[model samples]
Target: MSDSRSGLFGFVLNGLGHMFRGGLLYWAWLALLLVLIVLGGWHYYLQLRDGLLVTNMSNQVSWGFYISNFTFLVGVAAAAVMLVVPAYIFNRKDIKDVVLMGDTMAIGAVAMAILFVVVDLGRPDRFWHLIPFIGRFNFPESMLAWDVIVLNGYLLLNFGISFYIVYNHYQGKEPNASRYFPWVLLAIFWAISIHTVTAFLYSANSARPYWHNALLAPRFIASAFASGPALMAIGLQIIRRVSDYPIRQSVIDHLALVAAIALQVTLFFVLAELFTDFYNEGEHAASARYLFFGLDGHTALTPWIWTAVLLLAVALLILMIHPLRTHPVYMNIAFVLTVVGVWIEKGMGLVIPAFVPTPIGEIYEYAPSATEIMVSLGIWAIGLLLFTLLAKAALPVQCSFLREKAHREVTHDDA
Candidate 1:
């Protein structure tokens, strides 16, 4: 027991030590993250003191930048399933190399999503009201409560799995396959639930017709699959360039293919929703009109949505081409474009218009104030910082471990 404790202590201490020892670019990135976090903290301080009034969010559009980000990140967090299911279940060696990175990404994303929720709350001090033991947490009854529950569970699953595997690797031992497999399976299903519950949080709002649709949850999942893996594809490239780990081309190829399919599905769902909205020409269609084109001289969100659509189309074109998908240069560019396209589509494009020509027939245009923008960027900074630290610590150890294991196998074969 004493030896085990010492080993664990050494594992954590060694990992953290290497994470801080990075080159100039790493320090620059860390500096940038710190600046954003501090700036965001300042804005949040103002918000707490002055209330939601510090931002442009109003009674008509109660959810602004924070909720939109929360929505998008929930999908990103869930997207880790794209890697987890294949790597753990099928035991795809190519993907197994990078699966821990995906799970770590999930950890950062879930943490950021939770922070967004807490920040959006006007009275964060009363947060205990949402806790089961301390307050009236309406679990199973409140969709929000369900979101809280599942999100934390998903975080725990990812953090536990990622840490356990990496710990085993650090100890120069193969993890017990049986021990990790069930948890991997849990993460897969839980990923789906987290995003679905998030969608339901919006769809269940009977008053918001823009959100009250069966297709909303499906669209969320589709875009999530596209955006999350697209982000992961780019991340894998970054990891390979900076580290000794040789991420296989086959893994990148598979991710590109999956992202292409997922992006296609996202586009299809958007068209399906548009058809359902305009074809029937009901009261609900107003928000759709407000989004795609201008309605009643209100066109604030039009350009943004159209631009998202254009970028998605461009990204798809590049991703669909066999040669382009295989070329690292082209695929990485496409991946970035897809990430931006989805961010706009799911963030400002989806949320703003829905609230526009709001439920009470208020045609007021919603725009994020400077404070909101700063705070949003700050939350993102926090996520990136978390991811950067996690990858820095985990990757080198895992990569070296995989290398040693490979060398041993080859030696044994020769013997």
Candidate 2:
């Protein structure tokens, strides 16, 4: 028993060792992320010191860039289900090999989502009030309580599952399927709930006519499916180029197909929403107008939304066409455009519009102050750095250990 415990401890130490052993380019990349983090950290300090006054968020638009990012990342974190469903439930071996990457991405994304929420709060130190058992958590009543539970639960689920698999791989053994499969199933459902609950949070706001619609949750899920897998596909391409990992082209193709279909569904939802809003041309339509064309003369978000629409439209065209989708160049282009388009649409387009022409019919155009932008940039850098370190450590255990295990099985069979 003591030897077994020591072996597990040693394995952890070895993984930590991998985090610091990369080449000059890898180190340079780490340095760049660190610099950005420092700059962001410095700005965040300023915001904390001066209060949210440093940001452009006001009573007219209470939730600004921070919540916008938090909302989008919730979908990104939940989108891991896209990969999880196919890899585990359908038993796709190619995708299963790299699904750990999706889990790792979820961990980073959820962490970032949580950080965005923290920064949005006026008194972040009071965050424990949201803790159900310890604090004054309103759980079962407060949607924020539900969000806290799901985001943290989802983060732990991914971390636990990844650790189990990677630890087993390091031990030169296959993870017992029965032991982990049930948890994988739970993670899949939990992933969906995370985003669904987030959507409900918005839709529950009856005062905000822009968000008080039945279609919000489905729209969230659809856009999440497009953005999350699209982002993962980009990461996989990078991993393929940079490492000796045996990521198959088929895996990338599968992700592209998922993103393409999801993008189509997302666009349809957007069209449905637009038609519903403009058909009546009432007070509720005001927010949609501000988003797409602008409300009254305040056109702050008009250019941004149009740009997102154009990017998504072109991306859909590229991905839907057989030749373009198959070509690596075009496929990558579509993936990049899909990610950026969804970020703008789901982040700025969704969040800001709801508050615009506020319920009392006040017009205050809110933009992210330089401070908000810097803090957001810093938070993003932190997530990227976390992912980089995690992938650096886990990839060898995942790729090399599994490959060696497979090789031994084949050799024994031949003998």
lDDT of each: 0.90, 0.92
- The TM-scores of all predictions, comma-separated, are 0.97, 0.98
Worst window of 10 by summed lDDT in candidate 1: 1-10
Model 1, C-alpha of 117: deviation from truth (Å): 0.8
Which pairs of residues collide in candidate 1? none
Across 193-260, the per-residue lDDT of candidate 1 in tens digits comes to 99999999989988888899999999999999999999998888888888888798788888899899
Which sections of candidate 1 miss by over 4 Å? 1-6
